[model samples]
Target: MAETLSAPALPSVYRQLLDAIDIGIHVINHEGKSIIYNRKMSEIEDMEKEDVLHKNIMDIFLFNKEEESRLLQALNHGEVHHNAKQVYFNFKGQEITTINDTFPLIYEGKRIGAVEIAKDITRLERLTRENARDKQDARFTFDQIIGDSNAIREVVENARRATRTTSSVLISGETGTGKELFAQSIHNGSERASKPFISQNCAALPDSLIEGILFGSVKGAFTGAADHPGLFEQADGGTLMLDEINSLSAPLQAKLLRALQEKSIRRIGDTKNRSVDVRIIATINEDPAVSLEKNRLREDLYYRLSVVSILVPPLRQRKEDIPVLANHFVNKYNKRFQLNVPGIAKGVQQLFQEYDWPGNVRELEHMVEGAMNLIYYDERIDYTHLPVHVRNKFPSYNDISHAPEALVVPNAPPTKPLQEYMEEVEKVYIEQILKRHSGNVTQAADELGLSRQSLQYRLRKYRLNIRHS
Candidate 1:
């Protein structure tokens, strides 16, 4: 007979499983008493299990109120909270930040208790603050942008006009469309150019921490807190480039709107408001209208931030600029790599213009850099020197003429596993569909027989950074 598993051993197995998890786990009973606290939880909170076990939550944690404790909320109100950011002090007077998913435990249709899974991000918050404090100067100027197409020129003019005033500017475009470049150019041309230019990606942190990072905090605001200046204070009389502004939470948007209107901001838990003279330049990866419809952005804040709006056109719509950008990249890499490569082959140049360039100018630049790295004896970059992804984008890739010595074998069998192979094909197919629809996600989703959200998930999953129509 095989070895039998006993029922009593089940509890031990469950305990082991919980301890093995990477995230913190804390469970409480109906009386708000700690029942199970995993090893990860102890590690995250920097406390021992014995310190928490058999203790009331109120006795162990420093929550402001019973309702403020997510575990208590689940036990009392049967409410579920997902990806909620919580900032609170532990019994040891240390402040902690966590993204929590708390759910009520129900038995026989009656509330019993609650369990919470928490991810610690305190170090991330500290690092973000440190990075913001060490931000560098704006290097790119208006003259550095390569494109001369009417599409680019119009936006350049619009951005230039934005520099004349301190009005908030909203720049919208696809990823790698040079939104930050335009932002830097605008700041360098403005009166504040001599002052600081600090940039932050709003999506980099959760709302709870971003608030502190943006507005700062006093020493007594939270446990382990200190006197710190925020981005607004650091960027006083200068420019603050907030990239991916749509990623900010609703409460943050409201706070930001107030700050913009009042021309002042208050530190977290501080009563006094400090005035700032920072010019705001924000960027969004997609159209603002779509963001509003999706409830990802606030309309009032959009109007406030878009006082001077600029939309940078995608690469496909401005194909005429590809040759100039390509040549610029070639020249750039030549100087850096210390190589004397002549230029891109005529056929490769034609290919670059024909390709959809879902990743835009950034993609073109990377492709050139990749090809330059591969060249040794070649006098010029050619079709054969291109990255595999670029070549695979064309169905007639094999038909293109490459240097005779460039090939030993053709149509080699794929070395990757089947799952990887299928994913590659699927990614390329989705990209082609998006390109065909001119990056209209809804239309592409329809053609692909998928819901818009599902297609969007796949786009992110595959990292297919494409422009929206």
Candidate 2:
């Protein structure tokens, strides 16, 4: 025999692949006995492979109790489940709430077994509780905002002034503009600094769950809801930040107003009212006027919540602060990544100033962090280390230095005034861009290297109605 080769066994290959996966994988035969349980599954369930081998998956994960048998249901009825939530207890009494996607395993036109891919939410639940504890003792204060621009200082002044009183403060800004930082700083600087300071995103939870999270829940509120104290109670005598408050439904708005007026809340499925001495700090991504115009937020609630309003200016409006922020991020990441990075490259600083950060300061931080990851022994961060997305925001260095300015209109109407002719060229330029982008102001603005607000103002001046949607 000149040469001999053998392919890996199918079972061995599958076992290796399943073991490599990060999420738990479980399989059960038609009789509900475990057939393919991987190492990740064992680790997620806090069990051993030997314990789960040949045992029924329901028996192992659900502790010998058949409460809502997903595996059996799939195998017997050829059913499928996608992102279905389930809670079960292991033999060691560890409760795991998982989102599972179960599908029937078919062979030759017959259901052979069922397979399930699950992500254990046990750690997520723990982190959420720990987050509540962390909020009780926040770290970031007003001094940590790291910007000296008048735009930033104006908002900080308003926030600091509002901190003295327990009046409801509304801090409005886009994503990653450090709205939560302002909220926490206000709390820390307030008289209620010693008490708990809880913050929750109103948009994170569904309407049904949102109510219970804010006002709390009784034993029989819905289904599995235990006697839990809501965020309002947790932040009693302190601050409760309801971020993205515009996302709350109309009914919830009424309830929130009632709670604010009475300084009390009634838990779901409970009649007794609980009084809470909590300061409210609300954050909205959009302008309050726009929100009120669209009826996305209630009028009464807005008046109550915006007793002291603070609008954090977007990063683009205050590009002068980019140098300070960039240096701050470099120092922060140098210690984090254990590098001796000196500072940002001058070329990178220019690009950062030129680019419009749609995601605001968070995007800048992420870009810096990404650049740091790519850099190893370099003393200074440079343009080459910039992420592809950030690099793609503008033209290449060669293009910017050499690319010819595009012609607006080839036919020069010599009969008109120079200013009028220039206006015509501008109109034609805007028209073409709007048409190319299907009348999207944001995209057109980005392509033209102008801010969205500036583009909108020009559209009004030119009487162009570019449909944003």
Candidate 3:
């Protein structure tokens, strides 16, 4: 007689097959007790076989309503649920979000049990929401931050040291001082550069929304809420830049301090804690001492977040950097406007240095951009090209002319590439039309007898920046 495999050996083969599947397999008897919970199901629920096997589903999991538990519904009602999403908490207090297909099991024409095939989407749900949000691209690095002043160089050096470790950083500076720029640079230089570099402006959103955004939320946690991961979870293994952190309310500050200390966060209305690994870089637009004294920022939270503090000097303090920043913006707009302007005029440079820039580096950039909108190709930005407000600051600006002298070469021909020559001619012609129409693109396009969009495309193609006269 041939040897035969025993009946006990058959269940082992079936169990191995069930465990091999990626989807969670859960089987429950008519009494709603879990009869078979495969390895995948155990992993999905973060529960062990010993804990779930032979236990009632209700005893292991909490459902908002009996109807919400798909497995139980299948066993009790002989119903089949397909591609249904269920968000519920397990006994261990962990929130489990899954998409499930459940069906009642029938044997000999009698409803006996229920079987559920589940796809765990806890992480995917969070990632989907995170990707949907508008995120700024972290493109700046230490090399891109243009400033030669000692004040700025010292701040940059401290920020560079921050990248070497996973310490919390607090960057304090006035508004428009490029605090976010330094934050992005440090993130790019850190080991977590490859990971998500998430930024949230604490001042932009109200406290109610900010809490959910930073710590995440579960379905039914609030009206019109769904399962989602917070910034901490989304920025796991990376950096989280909180801009204007002092704007956060005091109660939120206490909560933030807890998350930093524990390295874990509890979702809104969640009972369980989720671990996260995130490097935080927070910024404030006032002195830390003033913010604390005014009760705007919590001292305890400040201490926690300021493992490394960096104070960026304002534009007025770092006046030496004004010329370099202006030049950088000029080069940037030169490509955008398709102009070949070499540099700014000396008169304009003198006024820029003399003025107390309340808006800091951002004001300088805007001034450069405004001037670029008014100039022609091959012309340096001059005093007359400066915006009216800048000119008004220096009443005698016209008297101080700094025009670029023509380099007269004996017997040298004015030879250039045909493409360059054509571009220059087209740019000047469009500019003249725009000037005639007071920079109205529609009127300019109609006067030029081209479609509005067509003329607009040409404007961009030739890098024209038209300002209304």
| lDDT of each residue in 319-436, candidate 1, tens digit only | 9999899878976775567554557776787888789888998998998899999985225777788877777776575466543342222232568677776677677778878888
Per-residue lDDT over 1-469 for candidate 2, one digit per residue giving the tens place of the 0 to 100 score: 6543336566677788999989999888877888888887888778888877797554455222243678877888878999998766664446677889999999999998999899888788779879867655665788899888999988888888987899999889999999999999999898988898887999998998889889999998788989999989988998898999999999999999999999999999898999999999999999999999999999999999999999989999988999999989986786567554667766677888889889899998998899889986334677678877766665563233322255467466668788887787888888888888999776786666554445666798999877853
Candidate 2 at 38: error in angstroms?
Answer: 51
The alpha-carbon lDDT assigned to residue 88 of candidate 1 equals: 72
Task: Name the runs in model 2 displaced over 4 angstroms.
Answer: 1-136, 398-469
> In angstroms, how far off is 294's CA in candidate 3?
0.4
Could you report the Cα RMSD, in angstroms, for every candidate shown? 24.0, 22.5, 25.0
Top model by TM-score, which number?
Answer: 3
- Greater-TM-score candidate between 2 and 3: 3
- For model 1, what is the C-alpha lDDT against the true structure? 0.85
In model 2, residue pairs whose N, Cα or C atoms come closer than 3 Å (at least 3 residues apart or on different chains), thus clashing, are: none
In the range 180-278, model 3's lDDT, one tens digit per residue, is 999999999989999989999999999999999999999999999999999999999999999999999999999999999999999998899999999
Q: How many backbone clashes does candidate 3 have?
A: 0
Best of the two (1, 3) by lDDT: 1
Clashing pairs in 3: none
Per-candidate TM-scores read 0.57, 0.57, 0.58
